[model samples]
Target: MINRISAVFLFLFFTLNASFAQQVLTFKGELAPIGDRVEILTDSNSTMSLRSALSSKEFKRSSGSQFPNLGTTPYSYWIRFTLKNESNSKAMGIQLTQSMMDYVDFYQVQGDSVTRTNFTGHRRPFNNRFVKHQTYIYQVPIIKGESQTIYLKVKSGKQLTLPIYVGSIEEVVENAMIIDLLFGIYLGIIMVMLLYNLFIYFSIRDITYLYYVSYLGIVMLTQASMQGYIFRFILPAYPEIADMFIYISTSLIGIAAIEFSKHFLSSKQYTPLLHRISYIFWALYGIQISLAIAGFHNFSYTMMLALAMVSAVYVLYMAVVIMLKGFRPAKFFLIAWTGFIFCVIIYVLKDFDLIFHYNNITNFTLLIGSAFEAIMLSFALADKINILKVEKEQSQLETLKALQENERIIKEQNVVLEARVIERTSELHEANEELNSTLENLKQTQSQLVESEKMASLGQLTAGIAHEINNPINFVTSNINPLKRDIDILLAALDEIEIVGLSDSTISAKQLRIKEYKEELDFDYLKVEINQLVKGINEGASRTAEIVKGLRVFSRLDEDDLKKADINQCLDSTMIIANNQLNNNIKVIMEYGELPLVECYAGKLNQVFLNIIINGIHAIHTKFGSTSGGELKIATYADEENVFINIYDNGIGMGPETQKKIFEPFFTTKDVGEGTGLGMSIAYNTIKKHKGQISVMSSPGEGSQFSLQIPIHNNQSLSHLN
Candidate 1:
């Protein structure tokens, strides 16, 4: 009785455990997600054999709706299930969707005996499999109403994901063909984007396109490595190399994505701190590459996927940050990466089992996302071309606008110039008419001038004779009466002495009378006075002779060349000629300094001096009105290079407004008709023609000082110098 009870209890316990261990799948000629009726068994050491897994009961059932996503587990994961084929299919197709798993061992069991076994994986040589395909696939024979027990031993250095598909072989191939078609389209898109960007890159020579193109190529290689295309086609003999490329390509794709975005978004310029941090990540990616190459593939793959997730987040973060900072291109970059990042997140979450998962979602997630991202980024590059086009048009428009503005301003100035010319012409016409009328009147009075050139007589002869001879003539007249009076007194004294001498008187008496008469007449004083009178007459005549000499000296004014002359002498001659204008009320102060002879037109310079002195005399007259307190101070000073003359007058000085226009033609402080206003203008021109300058300083209540300077030996272009 005790043996019976123990057997029953053990049997009951085994039944419950077997029923609870896994669910059975009834195949109906359609794809079945392997997770629906699968038991997942794990071994930490990856040393669990098929016999051990079948004997041990340490297994876990999977949720039916999703694949068993065991993220990054390496080696020794076992999945076992039972299948009942109800449809008319001879074979059940088992597809392990992930291609990079190092080994996959499939077993078909018949009532505790191993009927058949197939061994294949990405790490094994390509021909070792019963069926040569990208993913690990197995064909197990089944019949209607008969059940098949299956086992799959999976091992990888990357993520340990068992995304299995159970269906008829025909259905499996159809699904694979569908996948190939999709991959072809994706590859076509990537190649098209590459070519399109390449065209733009050559057209504009933008480095951003190069970075993005290289990124697309690496992304294509990464997907190819992950899908076993590289191992199948490129390096069939090198399974180990094909296995390593997945991690290397994973790490490189991350690095490449970062580099591409860094340039494409202008991250360094817009986000300086983040740009620096990106260099730190570059170093981390270096470590990742080292890990992948050094055969630490499990850690490397885990780190790579984690880093890829983080990298996607980081780049997306940078894009969002720079977009808010008003980077225009970043907005479009954000849109592209947002989609890519979304798919990457889903793909990663599926591996990590963070979200509710499915088998087909994993493969489709990144495909759709990456394709969409690549296409949109291509459109973004196209938009950049459009932006450049718009900017060019804007620049052209701005240039045209500036030209129009300049033309408008020039037109206005031309209009103003035309108006001014018309007004000036009218004024000239009126002045010419007045001049002609005056000429006619002068012609009517021509006989009175006796045909002596009127302008020449007035401008030259009158100016010359009046400025040259008046002083000598005045000297003669001033001394004539005094000389006459002195002579008469001396003659009277001589007569008295002669009478004294002729008288018949004794010698002592005559001597006494002569001495007495000399005392009485003051004859000694008379002698002195006679000598002084003769000296005065001589000086007057000498001055007249000097006047004649100066006329000869000044006659060269008609010559066309310059002459060397003394500036002080020029001033003195002007004063002498202007003597009649001077009265006792006006005191002339000479402050002459030692001066060098200057090369100049003496006649013209003389005229300048006359004009200035005459103006000063008038200024003094205006101030004192024939009184004796007015002063005309003339000063001359020199250096080795040039001579300087200053004429100052304590007169009714001009205001600022008058001084500004003082040298202008037809400008004068004098009442109209009393002055022609041409004197100072002509004087200024003469000074300028000598390569010289003239300036004035004055205030209304103070005084006026006019300074003139000229070089000592300048004989250059006198006309243009003005």
Candidate 2:
């Protein structure tokens, strides 16, 4: 009886093992399709969470190679499949074909416990996936005799099409490579189109190529992001931005496409109503992109869909209108847009679950459609170019005919024109002489005007220098009388001492007489007074010396040729010379850095510094209008190869338009006769002559910065050393 019972137990174990084996799908060299084994449950209300889904017995069994087509629905799907390892391969992975699902959750069930393996989606960061890849790939751990049940929950705003494949790691990698190769081929086509049209645009300066390139590039990027290539490769670190990019890029592509169509077919000329509709679609696209970038993604996506549909209808309408108007380019445009529209319709319908769904086809229909449209549009653009060439040739022929007709008319009137030629020759001679005289006079006047301007500038500088000189000179002149008086008093005291020594007087008498003389002369007061006078003289002399030095630097008498110029010294000299302008309200702040000697024309550079400084002072005064003032900061620094001078001012800054034209001759902000506008222009030229650059940054109400960059070691530096 015991032997019979043991035999029945062994038989039951073998029978169950055989049944499990039959249920498992095995593969050796290729992938195993897991879709056929999938039993799906639809959660219409999304009430079945992952925990409930794992234990739920309400799931319906379905057998197919893919999930049922449920386009753009709110229903959540739970897919159940049993995986078993009947082979020796331990390295196996399962990949879900749909990459753009917003949420995908994978669960592994062992006995009574359910383990949530991964919760990742396209909406989350791409790196958060258990296996970082373009698609959701999960590792399956199944021993040779063990079976594992797995569940995937998918929910998205898009249509649900899940195609599952289980394979070894090597096979999975091979499949990825194949898919990448296809994407590469598609992207290559897009890139070629973009670059080809871009080159055409540059070669011929055609707006059509410009519009086409923009449209193609936007479309390519949109498709790439939508298909997960952009997320996987381009912006993996910024997965949150990827969704926003999709909507924006898609909308922008619509704008570019409409703009391209408007220009390519001359819609404004051929079809006015269609042209206006294109503008409406363009505005709609702009609004969608704006909202998407501003973090209104859901609304943006909804609006984008609406715009895309409207754009498609407009494209078809424009194409028809242009064709009705007998435009040759319209046919290609019509064909290209028709193909694209058909694909978009199918894609949208599939998303809405209103059509039969093929996973790869529905996923890449836009890309495929765009590729077709781009190729056709390229042909259309080429045809348009050819048509323009023919038109140009015809125009040239007509011009030639008109010229030949005029030539015959002239030949017929040649006898009558002989008399007029004689009269016109005399008039030409008089006009030539008058023009010559006027030219000479104008040259002299211009020379005189320039000389007068220079003299006027010199006169103003002289007046300022004279004012600076007069102060110290006046101090010295006024102190001389007091100094002389103190010297006389000291001399008188010395004479009294000598007399006392020479005369026959007692020591007490001598002391009494000397004390009386000292008290009479106020000798102690004279001593202190003399010292103060001497100090005053010394200070006055030093002030005079400083003034002279500043003048010398301003004149640049020692800088006849290129010299090793200290930029900080130049700034100091300029400040000193322009003190009359900056002395009162405008404060000059110098932040000097350790610098190498810069080789430059010192005198011209000084002039540049003076001009900018004076301008800065004027700017401050204008901004404050005698009420308050601002600071002028001058900083000097040097790098390994170049020296930099930065002058910044907190004043009424210039607008962008003014900044752009600041270095242009006769461009100034000062009132009519106050500014020559040549100061900055001349400064720019002088800096450029020394192989340097001058740039300005300014914005109204903020302030302005003028930066000068000059090379530390130039050809002139070497020559000057020699």
**Predicted structure with the largest lDDT when compared to the true one:** 1
lDDT of 1 by residue, 473-574 (tens): 776777788778877877887787789789999889989998988788787887787777677767778978877666555444455666678888877766
Off by over 4 Å in 1: 1-24, 63-65, 403-722
**What CA root-mean-square deviation does each model show from the true structure?**
15.7, 19.3
TM-score of each model, in listed order:
0.53, 0.53
| Local distance difference test, candidate 1 | 0.79
Candidate 2: stretches off by over 4 Å: 1-37, 43-47, 62-65, 86-88, 286-306, 418-722
Cα deviation of 386 in candidate 1 (Å)? 1.3
lDDT of 2 by residue, 385-449 (tens): 99999999999999999999999999988977998898999999999999999999997875565
Q: Once model 2 is optimally superposed onto the true structure by TM-score, how far is the C-alpha of residue 282 displaced, in angstroms? A: 3.7
Error of 1 at 348 (Å): 1.0
